[model samples]
Target: MKTEYDVIVVGAGSAGCAVAYRVARESNLEVLLLEAGSADKNMMMHVPMGFAFLLKPHKNNWSYQTELEPYLNNRVIDLPRGKVLGGCSSINGMVYIRGQKEDFDRWAAEGNKGWAYADVLPYFMRSQHNEAGADAYQGTGGPLWVSEIVDEFPIHQAFIDAAVQAGHSFNAQVNGATQAGVSWFPRTIKKGKRYSSAQAFLGAGRALSNLTVLTHAQVTQVQIEQGVAVAVQAEVKGQSILFSARQEIVLSGGAINTPQLLELSGVGQQARLRALGIQVHKDLPGVGENLQDHWNSYIKQKTQGVKTYYSEGRGLALLRNIARYLLGKKGFLGDSAATIGVFYKALPQASSPDAQIHFAPAASEYDAQGNLRPIDAITISACQLRPSSRGSVHINSVAADAKPSIRLNYLATELDQQVAVAAFKKARKILLQPALQGMLQAELAPGADVQTGEQILEYIKSTGEPVHHLAGTCKMGSDAMAVVDECLRVRGIQRLRIADASIMPSLVSGNTHAACVMIAEKCADFILRSSLIELVSPTRPFGR
Candidate 1:
């Protein structure tokens, strides 16, 4: 491996892949993209419906469980992050949601300049090649292929109809003019295969002479020299190696690892760093603060006459589906996990959709041995689009390989609790609609006995799971707790920036993969533009 490069981007996940790709292509900068996990060469990773097998504690997945959450009856929740090239995008359901426009506006409102809906739309467009064609909201001619699910099931349409019958409008394109109502979800798939960030961006940049992509390289810490990030120390195949960055060092290690890396590098709370016996470099209290994730509560029902994934995903049917997918890239295997989506307001007083429902024509449960077993049921999982509850992630040890303490205080706030309950009730209402009622045999989870709001809240506390749309640990804003500025440059650290979900001032209203790509697009633009300016400046020293 090379000892130096123009730029070193840590964590070859969703944002890291994009940033490295853009920087290498847009500029002549030599870029080093480092991933702590193995290559994305797994056969299942390419299959659209293969994410289910990758969700557990697999080699490609960093299945980190949260510290016992106090708000959720002290239960530890599984927090699976992708340890592969594409990061979570590889293991995710492939749902391509950019979130509500107001989500970005809220960031601008929180003093994060140049992050409004209008300001960031171009970046989203630039990173996406929506196969449905381009319009005011959608974009074409990009690396990331965003298209509708290839194989649409009857149950998906039935769920959509049921949601509409439940008073929600039918929106064909949720990422278009407005993000509201029931709609078919767009996915990051191409030619009936999972098109992860690695496939979208890194695939195009891998052959570039200026770009060096390394797998199984775990970054330990950023070496700050005179308050400027100069290099990163990483363990590559169990060998300690240091790579110096000439221009910039970007951290794209998602919400969890980015903050953990910062804290380990002594860029977090002074007291915490000192307590860990680490020399403080930059005392930024927000390094691991403001952690947020969507908490999902599901309402599952037994299916009577419908053929869900439960039936088709096992036995002879499974073999047939696999053959069909291999032959023509068609069948149940070519579909995303959740095909139908409902973005609606759970609270009547809220403007726009404050909650989201993901309808899957399948249900499964983890056995005592942690094996996933499909059940004869369909599920409609609901989550507060904009959760008010805030949680945190912090390093419990100075060791780089040690897992960090993740406290996802789900339903900690009154508003979050109310929204969770309201969304759950709304999902149940949709499931009970005439269109779905004809197919559903009975409510399997949170049955008729759990009807009252209090009962629903209790059920949620017991069953709520993280949707894995984790963000906001390294927030971007003008506030004191903001770890990055609007340009994504890390506060109190020169020549360092973060381009990942961690920089989100707050969680976006939906799945975060699209938003993370957009952030990386903008981050690359900023780096390239700054380099151009510095190159032409008379007073600036060249190659300092």
Candidate 2:
């Protein structure tokens, strides 16, 4: 393997893969992409429904448990991050949501220049090949394949009709001009296979002569000299190796790992670094602060006569579905976990849709051994789209392999609690609509007895789970606590940039994979533009 490259991208996940692919494909610069996990050769990594089996402790998953959350009954919630070549995009539900446009506009409002919906739309368009065809909002002819669910069941239609009867509008495209109302979710699946970032970006650029990729190579630290990032120290097969970067080093580790790496590299709070017995290189207090994630709550209902995945996932039915998928790339096995989605305003005072719900004609629970077992039920899971609560992630150990401390601090604020209760109530209301009332037998979770707002809040505190859309650890802005500037360059450090969810100043209103890709597209543009300018003026300093 080469020791040096023009650009080095750490963590070959969603953003990292895109950054490396764009730099290698668009320019003549040499690029190296590193991933801590093994290759994406696992069968489960490609099968859409295989994510169910991967939810537990698996080789492709970094199933880190959070520290006991103070607000959620001191419960330790599971935080599943992808450890494979595509990261969470490979193991995710495959649902493709670009979030509300106001989400990006808010970022631009927060002093993050060039991040508004208008400014970032081009990047979003440049990253995906939406099978639905290109419109003013959607794009085509990109690497990532964005497809609509091919097969829709009776239960899906029933749920959508019920939601509309409950006063929600029926939207054909949630990721289009407006993000409000019920719709069938679009997915990152193409021809029955999970189209992950690794497959979309890395696979397309793998044959490029200047591009190199190494899996199972964990980056331990970024070597800094006089505030300039020079190289990265990585552990490959129990051996330490130093890889130099002639131009720039891009950290694309997601929210948790990015902040943890920054802290480990001595770019965090000086006091915290000293307390952990680590020498400080740059005192950036916001390296691991302003953490954010969607706190998800769900309502499950037992189905009376409806056929759900619970029954179809067993015995001869399971074999039939498998055969169907294998033969024609069509069946439950080829579908995303959630086939329908609802975006609505839970609070009347909110400007846009403040809550989002995902509907599936199936339900499951963890057994005593923590294995996910299917149940005979349907589920409506809800989460506040833009939460006000903020938590943090920081390293608790000096070792690179040690898991970092994750505190979601979910429902810490009164507004968050109110939104959670309202979203839950809204979900229940939709389930009770006449269109779905004949299908649902009874409410299984929180029960019919729990009707009051206080009871709903209590139920949420006990059962809320992290949606795993973690972001904002290394926030990008011009504020005091911002870790990166508007250009994605780390503050007080040169030749270093972050191109993942960690750079989000505020979490988007929906699934984060699309936004992470957009961030990477923009990051690559910045780097490539700088390189072009430097080429024109040979005497100019690099990445100025």
Model 1: runs farther than 4 Å from truth?
A: 533-544
Q: For residues 1-544, could you state the per-residue lDDT of candidate 2 as single tens digits?
A: 6799999999988899998998887777889999999899989878898888777888888998889998998999898889989999988888889888899999999998889998988888888899989998888888899998865467788888899999999999888889999999999999999999999998889788989999999999999999999999999989899999999999999999998888889899999999999988999989888989998898999998777888788999999988998999888888897899999999999999999998889998989877778999998999998889899899988999999988878899999999999999998899878898778897899798999998999999998778889999999998889999999999999999999999998989999999999999999888887773233233221121
lDDT of each: 0.89, 0.89
Candidate 2 residue runs with Cα over 4 Å from true position: 532-544
For candidate 1, write residues 366-445 as lDDT tens digits.
Answer: 88767567889988899998888888999989999999998978889999999998888888888778887678887889
- In candidate 1, position 142 carries an lDDT of 85
Q: What is the C-alpha RMSD of each candidate to the true structure, in Å?
A: 3.3, 2.9
Q: What does the lDDT read for residue 57 in candidate 2? A: 85
Task: Report the lDDT of model 1 for residue 36.
Answer: 98
Error of 2 at 180 (Å): 0.5
